[model samples]
Target: MELLQALQDRRSIRKYKDTPVGREAVEHLLEAARLAPSWKNQQCWRFLVVTDAAKREKILAGFGDDNPGKKGIAAAPVTIVVCADPAESGIENGIHYYVADTAMALEHLCLAATEMGLGTCWMGLFNEDLIRKGLGIPPTFRIVGITPLGYPDQDPKPRPRKQLNEIAYFEKWGEN
Candidate 1:
């Protein structure tokens, strides 16, 4: 599918089929994320693909009882944890580049999943320490996000978005 089409089609998939996602497809999605640009090319991002039921349970433990993503995590055939090392990225003007870098990579992964007829939901509200401990992730790494991947069980309509004129400007800020 074209990039624009993928972008348009991508959604926060909260429901998934029992179908398993193959290794090649997972790798293909990761490759798309790997090619994403990073701060100074430090490539602070790391991905943990969890297919084991035990490991999935450990990940689920990190999520709160109220997080809507828990259902998707429990249902999807696979889960991916996105991590980033701050030391591997730069900080400027009080902004951490690691977060931005990993976020771009995660978006790439999600879009690739959409193009491949797979589903993903970028979930962030979780206990970092719990996930790190359960997943055996190094203390140096930050759990940026988690996602469930599989064949989508539901097709959700697109959510509302701000119009370009409302969010954009012609040369100067707020100049339409």
Candidate 2:
């Protein structure tokens, strides 16, 4: 699909089919993230692909009681936990840069997933500590986001977006 088309069409899919997703497809999606630009090419992002049933349940527990993505986490064929090493990416002389760099990589992953006929949701409202422990992630790495991957069961209409004029500014902060 065209880049613009994918950008416009991709939505946060919460419902998924029971059909299984292949390893190659997952690899392809991760490859997109692997190639994403990072600060000084530090490549601080790390992905954990969770497929085990028991483990997936544990990860699901991290989500809040009312989170819409809760079922997506449990039912999707796979869930990828995105992480970042603070020592890498945007770090400069003791400052941290991983947050911005890792975020870019995650965006790349989501866009690639959309282009590949897969569904994804950027899950931020979750228990970080539970996730780290559930996935056996080291304490030094930060849990950036989680995304469930599968064939979408529902085709949701696009959610409302702010007008470009409301968000965009010219050379100056308030300039149109």
Candidate 3:
């Protein structure tokens, strides 16, 4: 698919079918993430692919009761846990680069998933501690986001976006 079409059409899918996703497809998605640009090529991202039913349930438990993505978490064939070693990305001469590098990689993964005819929802409003413990993630690694992946079951309408002029400015901060 063309890049612009993929970017415009990708939605936060909250419903998924029962079909299984192939391992090759999963690898392809990760490969896209791997190619994402990072701070000084630090490439601090790490991904955990959770396919086990019991573990998926555990991850779902981390979501809040009111989270709309709760069902998607439990039903999707794969839940990718995107993590980052913060120290590696931003620690240039003892400075923290924060989450910029990790965020870039995740955006790439999301776009790639969209192009591969798969659905994805980037989940952040969840219990981080529970996820870290449940996934046996190292204490030093930061859990940036979790994306539920599978074949979409719903065709949601696109949400509105602000006009370029409304949010963009020219050379000056307030000048369009």
Candidate 4:
């Protein structure tokens, strides 16, 4: 599939089929993520794939009842937890790069999943501390996000996006 087309077609899949995702496909998606660029090649990102029912249950408990992604997490055949180590990245101009580095890797994984006829929903807004303890992630690492992976049960239309003119500039700010 074309890259931009996959980007356009990607959706936050909330419902999933009961069919399990193959390990090969998961590894392929992770390989795409592994290729993402990072500051000084730190590669601070670490992905935790939760397939065991027991582990999934523990991770699910970390997500609050109000988190909209909870349903998706519960339905997916697998959940990938995105974590990062700040010490592996650096700060520049008062902006920490670890977050950006990790986010890029996650997006790469999501896009790859989209291209593979799979589904993913960026699941943030969870209890970080609880998730860390439940997942047995080191305290030094931050839970950047989580994503459910599986064959989508629902095909959602694309959400609204800011036009290029509104969000991009050719030469100057507010100049197209």
In order, what lDDT does every prediction score? 0.95, 0.89, 0.89, 0.93
List the lowest-lDDT window of 10 residues for candidate 2. 87-96
TM-score, structure 4 vs. true: 0.97
Tell me how candidate 1 scores on lDDT. 0.95
* Ordered list by TM-score, greatest first: 1, 4, 3, 2
Those runs of model 3 whose alpha carbons end farther than 4 Å from true positions after fitting are 91-98
Per-model TM-score on C-alpha atoms: 0.98, 0.94, 0.94, 0.97
lDDT tens digits, residues 1-176, model 4? 99999988999999998799989999999999999999999999999999998888888888888888798889899999999999999999999999999999999999999999999999888888988998799999999989999999999988999898999998888899
Number of clashing residue pairs, candidate 3: 1
What is the alpha-carbon lDDT of model 2 when measured against the actual structure? 0.89
What's the CA error at residue 145 for candidate 3, in Å?
0.2
Clashes of 1: 0
Q: Please tell me which model should have the higher lDDT, number 3 or number 4.
A: 4
Clashing pairs in 2: 90-97
Tens-digit lDDT track for model 1 on 1-176?
99999999999998989998999999999999999999999999999999999999999999887998799999999999999999999999999999999999999999999999999999999999998999899999999999999999999999899999999999999999
